[model samples]
Target chain A: MNVKVIVRGKAKGAVLCAQKPVNFLGGIDKKTGLVRDEKHDLFGKFIGNKILVFPNGVGSSVGAYTIYSLKYNQSAPLAIVCLKADITTASGCAISDIPLVVAEKKDYESLKNGQEILVDAIEGKIL
Target chain B: MELTKEEESALDGKHGETLALAYRILVAIGEATNADKLIPVEWAHLSGVNYNTIGDAGEEFLSHLSKDAKFRIKTTVNPMGFDSDNVSKFHLDEEFVTKQQSIRNSYVKMGATPSFSCIPYEIFELPKNGTQVSFAESNAAIYANSISALKTNKESAFSALASALTGKSPHSDLRDEENRKPNLTIRMKTEPADEITYGLLGYFAGKEAGSSVAISGTKGLDRRSCKSLCAGMGTSGSCGMFTLGEEEGEKIDFDYKEMARVKDELNTSESGDIITLGSPQLGLEEISDLVAKLKGRSFRKQCMIFCPRAIQGQIRNLGYDKELTRAGGEILYDCCTCLTPLVDKENIDAVVTNSVKGAYYLKTSNGVDVNLKSLHQIVEEETK
Candidate 1:
């Protein structure tokens, strides 16, 4: 099911990914390629292959750098979609060089885990 | 990717060493954040107090800046790494103990203040809002700045502090036309009807609605994945563990494993029944009061009290560590008291807390009947 999603926040657009499960709402310390928080659900797992989903983000300043590190290590996520597209995500996306998109209310919660994400951050859709 | 003349001057070590370090760090952070220019910052709530987290980076950085020492700006910093006492808790593993202590020693050897309370603002006043403040804070501090005080805090404290010390930070906030817009509107729940403490009320209000903690608004309230090993509870200052009346129930729900882990830590050893968390932020007044209360009560020795590291150091400075050590004063850190702290939960029955989050979590996490009294009242009832 290729669903086109639109989100209304700071930055809204579409990319090549759509409604992928937002596995965790934290970071994957791009430098070490390890999930930094010992308490997260996906604590030790790598974010290399998953279609990572989240609202904006919260936690360490190491966040943006971690994204860059992930990209450098060839473990970056396929795409990113944020509910609140703010500086934090913007900076992270700019560095990791990952495909970016924003979510529309029409596709926000409806994008369940395990779905493929085809997004256009500029178009603000997931098709 | 671009630097202004002022930024380049700091980067090229034009301003003194402290500012230079601040610039270097903030430049890295800004680049990480994809900002092309810097913003002005004066007051910053810097974290790096804890070791490990802010330990190595802080020690190395500060050691260099403060080394052949002098003053760039007489500034205050609230570091995130370990303070002295955090290094000495849960000595179950000597190796872990040694590592923690060494790192702590390194941080302190420099000029960093070991004022290990989450609420630096409570202890010392910060600059006012629209005051062009810069700060480095995580969860609670970020919320306090963005919502409680409506100030501007960067992603983390390190970023904020670096910017503040150097006089420049991210060019992305407030100035960027496209990014200046806002979203997410979280409503703190409690009314000011004397129904709850202001702090506790806000926490509960957010929790009751399963509020998502945000930079400004409320959209990210989802709690589908809070089971990470580090369940962080923010502090306003150094508070006792039994402090309560906050609203975490709506925000978090413990799983079966978490529940068990929660149950396990409530148990304390009854070696001589005179258990006490080591000192620094001593509830001495509370202790005096508690002793008075228990003058004629039973189980006088079956008492426990939480003492902070600052108080412990004071005791050591006063030549009393050996005496206090002999008096059965054990030590604990505030962070480890969360959902399940790998302690014996069954043996303990009473608790005393100064931190609203601590008291509330203990009561909510366990069926333990705890008290949200002042440091004095806690000592009084328990010691008495």
Candidate 2:
């Protein structure tokens, strides 16, 4: 299997395999499921379930609502896949009720958003 | 798939009525999220200031049926809105009082606090980064929890309330170690512009991305609450136009009832520009000052005022909203009017205002004319 890594870093915790994809529309609003902070690459994408692949979190607290709104609007990706975890994404999962997983640093380095990845949060494993 | 011992007991009438009521509410929330099974809660935050004119009827039932306010979690934080302090502070007036009271009284009988607004960050010292807890629907609270990644179950408002009562929810949807990882990561550096409200700027970026999402994000937000852009904001329109005052700052509180008295007298005829200061939910003296400002001038291409719908209505009812709206410049709701596509596309040149949040969001998102100003200074600048 071809292994590709985005940002090199150490991750702690479980890794889950993803079948779908979530786009990274940058910071998501919690109250409204809209993408926020035009500075982000995927600015203006109502992110739901395309396999959001990101290193960490950014932007305002209100973005949490946007993430939730994305879930409600059917815009959120199947699950949140991260190289490193951040509060923004965590908040999105918490409010959106979407599944979120993290990988070990070695796995996080080898992981890719589009690439098929497996993670076990309870056991803290990533593949 | 069944409730935990604590939850079952609450449902079975083991806990007191208060908790039972919250549990019932949580059940609905879980259903809405399509949670496979509820999970045992770590804690909970009771959100709901004054009751909306309408809300989850189930919560009302739980509140009534369970008077003892049962509790499954060892600790919880529930905040109410629109009490005397909120009424005085935010300017929720008589009509607001009556409407909210009727709704709250129903739940209050079950031990709900009659407060208003959902800025949970204000009252609750929630943990950050995966803090597990169940949270209900509230724009403000949602904002706080999501920003910090405080653990919360995105169940329906009703389900959270149910959980409050029963104390146990199905643990079906809590992300396994595998599913909770973030997939897409985006990073960018904005030319930190002057006069931009730091927080709102982040929001603007989210808004832009939201627009791009396959799903329409705004439509969903509307379902939650009627936004009051004008309610808690201030604006300015001298020479050009701008909103004045920050959502966070030294509060410029008002008495809405007093302002309503002079509601009939306010007009936005001031010529060169206009400046708004703080929330338009004002008292009588403030209205008198506005009417006086409009006494000798006519609105320009820069006719603008940032106000909540309530105050805007008062202005419109007094023959201002129509005049303003007809001029292709009217009040906005929920979110700021200027932030809307209307003004951003139109004549918003070299913006100046008192609100750091607005300044930050606009400057960062659109790269527009932005400046920071004090409420009084904005008025002075616009007229100059």
Candidate 3:
């Protein structure tokens, strides 16, 4: 079963899961696409061209630009899977044309790093 | 979601690529949030202006957008990466200036006001109560909703940019009065008279509210105090906007016990080398007050006052800039310590500020030591 579609797009990529809330702004390096926050679980991990998964977003309204920056630099994730979708991540996904899915609690728990996933946003499926 | 004819046309690409992209973003966000339709917005206050925060990729994104887009509504930008005049003074390298200035040029090319500040409400002419607009900055959005009575979603910078291009936003949540009615109420034990109390109230209330609408029972909060409270609340979580004073809701009694805990959390044992103010952008009066306090004294370490360029000019005209600089104060413009890498670059071990939001970000996001103090206390400690 897939999560609810927040932004309608289709993508398939390896997973990069973050258990805690992700602060995109100042949290990730735009050029390198690496998570910069030393405190984050996925610190030093590159998010480019993956299916990024996090619980939700936190910090800085400017974080939306970080998402856009990721896309502009060709480092944005292919899709996003979150436990709950907040306005910050939603706006980022919408503007950047990134497929965003808010998963069920069980589905969110089951998601793991490096899991090859296919996101069908129109049909609302994850395979 | 229902879209008006013009909006639909814009979404359909009849109005060109810029409007179409903006429309698409609005529609997508609206659908996700279960918005009924689009509503016209009078203004947009944009964030994502700093280069140190947004970096090279963000500069490219803004450039591309501005190449094809012109704002449909009046829009104001947030602070830039560095104070232009103080780039060398702040010890910013040459490349940093180029990248940061590119961001400013893009937004200015797209017709956004060069008024760089997080507190855009003061720079722009705000609409009457119930006026619909899009604001992305957390503190500014809270201030607009709670104090100015202007309706806005605590929008992200991307959405605010879309609203600027389309002059419309998804009609959801804060746009409607019925939805804004408080679901959680924090009843304070004492009147929140000081800035610290207001900040604590906001911090405590944010946790209590937690994705639910909240209102504070504390009354007679001055504008700065209200702002401080909201800034604290914003740091706790994405609680959106909270109401101050009594309103109908589920009441949560808060007393001195809660205040004590919050106070403890906000402070640190470490001494700070730098005194930075205005994460939410200091007001004109606050700047003046700081100037008056630091009239003759010279600080041992750097004292940085972060504000917009316009206000910096205003202070310079009033001769406060000279007094502040003479007393070892640097009235920096465009960026604050919270949003930029200046603190880390300068190797600032610690920071002391009156801003609860500022302190929270410094600790959590920036990974810097922070000690919270009232403006009066900070002034006393720094000046002497």
* Number of the top-ranking candidate, with TM-score as the measure: 3
Candidate 1's residue-wise lDDT over A74-112, tens digit each?
776766665544333444454334655555555666666
Ranking by lDDT: 3, 1, 2
Ranking of predictions according to TM-score:
3, 1, 2
- Candidate 2 or 1, higher TM-score: 1
* Number of backbone collisions per candidate: 77, 165, 0
TM-score: model 3 vs. ground truth? 0.90
* Real contacts recovered, all predictions: 0.07, 0.01, 0.65
Stretches of candidate 3 off by over 4 Å are A13-19, A29-50, A72-75, A104-116, B189-193, B210-212, B217-220, B253-269, B292-298, B364-367
Return whichever of 2 and 3 wins on lDDT.
3
Q: How does each model score on lDDT?
A: 0.40, 0.37, 0.79
Ranking by DockQ: 3, 1, 2
The DockQ assigned to candidate 1 is 0.11
Give the per-residue lDDT of model 1 (tens digit) for B105-176.
443444335455333443345556545555444333434443335344344544554543455567644334
